[model samples]
Target: MIFESSETSGFPVATPRAVPPSGRRPGWNKVPEVTVYFWTIKILCTTVGDTAADLLKEKAGLGLTGVSVLMSTVLAVVLAAQFRSTQYRAGVYWPTVALVSVVGTLAGDNLIDATGVTVETASSVFVIALAIVFVVWYRRERTLSIHSIDTTSRESFYWLAVLFAFALGTAAGDLVSQRLHLGYWLSAVLFGLAIAAVGLAHFQLDLDAVWSFWTVYILTRPLGASIGDYLSRPSGDGGLELGTVVTSALFLMVIVGLVVYLAATRVDVTDPEHTSRHVA
Candidate 1:
């Protein structure tokens, strides 16, 4: 891995160069490498999160409060296991992310239902909160790259950022598709285009890699939610009518398959020696 800091913004910009993995160790880093598999599984997890929340709430008869408490407890437990581990295991790490997605969706739903908050307002607040987390994280750690998350404090910041991003994505997705009445398919298209533009800026126009990565990361949540809604909602509501259970099951199966393959292959493991040398 290689990165250079821009003097104007002080953000590390990754260069498209890497060393051969001569002495690399799997599970040395606390996060997976930013690869196609990572993004594919991430979007799947978000889609599952969106549909599963609805499944547990409506079909299971858990209601919003009950589902919130149940998922939050489970997330706390998984997160504890993640923190206790010294390195990244795909099993531990991906579960934590999936649970975070569920909890984050429930959080946004609970806040809106409980307080009658507008989706636009909730979206704005989450954006501010996420921005604050990044500011504090960068100030304390001097770099916001996932490759640099070798310490406990950095991991804490990373999770906090992830949680907020999920919440913000939920709110933003709702604002566009529900509140603004743009419809789910259109919302998905818009976010997908935005992610494509960000990719173009990063790969072809010299945008900072850290910014590109986080920008895509945040955008995927809304895109995935839109897709989940489009697939699972009733046909009367302009969806394919697969229902939440079917949609969640299909996406979860794909996610499990991918994670299992990645675990067996260890293709997404970061080279600690290379990361430490270049990430800062």
Candidate 2:
């Protein structure tokens, strides 16, 4: 997250730099390779995470803090297993994502409801933290491409960034809907459009891959949360009245099906040759 300010022939130049080098290595990709399927399942997981957490908190009688801790502990275990595996195993990777998504959402909830932090302040803090993580990650690894996530350190940074994005998204989403009173459906639509804008910028406007990935990452959290709220909240709360348990179960099934398919087929495996071409 270190910003480099230097004089280039007496002209000031500002360069954003990561602290850790990008850890360009040859092996299973550290970050999940991006694909339409990747995005599709990610949003699904986020929704599941949101609804499931809510159900656990309300129906299961675990308060917000208790549920957050439980999910965070589970996420840590899953992530540890994910890191231990040598290859990009979809089975390990996506479950870790789902657990972390739930934990991350709770983190934001704790910050606002438990601590009374303003959404604006929480969002701003998360942005700064994310920037710092990126700065350190890039400075050590030397690249920020997901295709280069081969080392342990870089993978750690990647997950930290992911965690922050989810938390940030929660706060930002709540800010728009609750504070600004935009309502669930409208907020979901807004974040959806924002995601589209990021895609357009990435594909057509030639945005940097690092920027595109992170931008979309943040947007996805709120988008997923919106979806979760829309499905699980009471009819009085603007949801479809499906209840959290049913919505969570439905999404979990879909996620399991997709993960099993990816694991069996290796559909999302990053092609080493294709990645090398991009680097070259």
Candidate 3:
């Protein structure tokens, strides 16, 4: 999601550097209900998502549109299951993210492959749409902090923002690699550096948490996609020859293991009363 100056909305906002509550639950927070483990596994999942989708289309003989529709339907079911849960459940949440990642990547891929829209144009459209969603969300709620995502509306907005981020990331990544001809490894390195810069800005420069989180979140998608492409694509195409099936299987196993661990440890629950402390 795009970041905007809070001053534009005329809302009474707290200082951006405010500390989050001490008693926050282990899970269920609006800030992407996963841990660093969540991020690690999420990147892995995205890699698998990209590779698996390609395999389905190229090897399984399902065309781009067919794979998109199939994965989108699966994603819909998983996302519905996620929304139905009243509290954070790692078992449900991570799989939902993985599925959505695949679906979102496929959506972007379809736009490029089927509709012939330039990645630059697709990136611009998604970025604008995500910005609008964020602006409307902030205007209505008076805050864009994920820590405050307790209500249905906030959660809905959160997931929608995530979906768009994945799509935007796909387009942006493709634009950099294909259109800009940067190559997969170089693009991956660039996005990794960008994420590190955002982290530095967040911790050292005291950037807004919500903005930092979303920015890094978007960067991770391309980073993951690059990694996936580098692993699965042939050497002639500037990638290793590992193949999509192996890459997907390996990443899926890692994601499942991490999600199971999170479920057992309860690492992502958020306490309702403590939500206010994170509003900045």
- For lDDT, the strongest prediction is 1
Q: Rank the candidates by lDDT, best first.
A: 1, 2, 3
Look at candidate 3 and give me any clashing residue pairs. Answer: 25-269, 26-268, 26-269, 27-268, 27-269, 27-270, 28-268, 28-269
Q: Please give the CA lDDT of all the candidate structures.
A: 0.82, 0.77, 0.75
> Per-residue lDDT tens digits of candidate 2, residues 156-224?
988898888888888888778877677678888999999888768756876665676678878888888
TM-score of each: 0.89, 0.88, 0.86
lDDT (0-100) at residue 96 of candidate 2?
Answer: 89
For residues 24-98, could you state the per-residue lDDT of candidate 3 as single tens digits? 332355333435675787788778778887888888677887788888888889888887776777888888788
Candidate 2 regions off by >4 Å?
Answer: 1-25
* True-vs-predicted CA distance for residue 181, candidate 2, Å: 1.8
Quickly count the clashes in candidate 3. 8
User: Native-vs-model 3 lDDT?
Assistant: 0.75
lDDT of 1: 0.82
